[model samples]
Target: MTQSMATRATVTVAAELTDRCDRCGAAGKVKIGLAGGGELTFCGHHANRFADGIGTAAERVVVESGFGWKGAQPI
Candidate 1:
């Protein structure tokens, strides 16, 4: 795969605690992987507020909405 696709493939749910919001510095509940090899974390409110921008720039978006649901697994 290309470098960009490789970066996108690397996006994974943080196994530890949640990250800090990039906007308000609150506890982050959402994580977005950018088109390149960068990521942005945000709380629920900020994620909602910046949904459009995130949707536009993000190659992958993962939100931890308190369900504690981990990501997919190998079959």
Candidate 2:
């Protein structure tokens, strides 16, 4: 497979397998990768709450809203 295709496949798998928030254990809606190292997972609520602090330091940030997932149901 081509490099971009492989990267897409990897991202799909990661999305399927990623666990819940590191803080409250709710389903993660945002993923933050650090420039130095490590990563953080947070639900939308916590992600927004902490964005001012950690967002500035992140090297990469991926956010998928709750409405974008197959498993998410209406409130």
Candidate 3:
């Protein structure tokens, strides 16, 4: 089932994305906190493209405010 916005709020949402994308050195928009304890940050483009896979494995997701992320839902 899809998660509601309220439930999604549990994940950290930053005002601005300051990190560079791990895949490509672009402005990061999404941050995926791994279940095992690390994190991966991504730009909007890469994040959406890999959303499905990342969503399933992430522990917590932190997206830039106002940035629409395909993998915003909690697994």
Candidate 4:
């Protein structure tokens, strides 16, 4: 059977909670708003490890785009 829109929405909301990877800080496709009001963006690793911890500690952890930490660009 097909899922209803309401069900999908609920699933979406739940999925949002599992976005980023806490360990490596990998940002996922969707960006979610945190409880405290801040933002957090992780890649994949970091989010998984500390997702719960970070979420509780801060409001949000926004994921950053572009170059590396050292600000180095590829040739």
Candidate 5:
């Protein structure tokens, strides 16, 4: 079965951002998927800043494991 256009777009953006982040020596995953399908990556600190942007730019942000802290759980 053929993939939908949105799926294809998301894949393409993910791949592109992943490569860019790697080339840039970024530590964490290249977060993609915000409003209008925008893609971007963030280091340990900036990840939080981009968190909202990621949610707004693409449909969903893809987070790479082994890059950032998950924070403590609430009691």
Candidate 6:
């Protein structure tokens, strides 16, 4: 993955994602665009579980409004 892609992310707030978690079949609270390519949606539990990695690996992240995703930076 390119450093530019990994570092450049469009962060947004959301209520729910378009689909379920990529890692697990649960409601998605955070949606992430990958640095390599593609996207991932994770439940609140998983989002917190992979916070540190997500912060570095995601190209973009959409977090629920008013909901804190450890990997997300406020916009």
Superposed on all Cα atoms, the candidates' RMSDs to the truth, in angstroms, are 8.2, 10.6, 4.3, 13.3, 10.9, 5.6
- Supply the TM-score for candidate 6: 0.75
lDDT (Cα, tens digit) per residue for candidate 4, span 2-58: 422111110121234345643354546323345646555555445434434443454
Residue-level lDDT tens digits of model 1 in 1-75: 221111222334554436899889988877888888798987767876665566567787776645232222111
What lDDT does the true structure give each of the candidates?
A: 0.61, 0.55, 0.79, 0.37, 0.42, 0.77
Compose the digit string of candidate 2's lDDT tens values, residues 1-56.
22111111111214432658999999887676777788888776776667555545
Best by lDDT: 3
lDDT of 5 by residue, 24-52 (tens): 45654556555664556555455544443
- Tens-place lDDT per residue, model 3, 1-75, is 564333322367899988999999999999888878888999999988887767677878898999988666535
- Where is model 1 poorest over a 10-residue stretch in terms of lDDT? 1-10
lDDT of 6 by residue, 1-75 (tens): 222223346788876566798888988889898988888888889998887678788888888776677655433
* Candidate 5 TM-score to native: 0.41
Query: Candidate 2: which stretches are off by over 4 Å?
Result: 1-17, 65-75
The superposed Cα distance between candidate 3 and the true structure at residue 71, in angstroms, equals 1.7
Candidate 1's error at 50, in angstroms?
A: 0.5
- Native-vs-model 2 lDDT? 0.55
Off by over 4 Å in 5: 1-25, 68-75
**Best candidate (score: TM-score):** 3
Q: Mark the 10 consecutive residues where model 4 has the least summed lDDT.
A: 4-13
Name the TM-score of candidate 4: 0.32
TM-score of 1: 0.63
What local lDDT does model 4 show for residue 11?
A: 10
Error of 3 at 49 (Å): 0.4
Task: Tell me each candidate's TM-score.
Answer: 0.63, 0.60, 0.79, 0.32, 0.41, 0.75
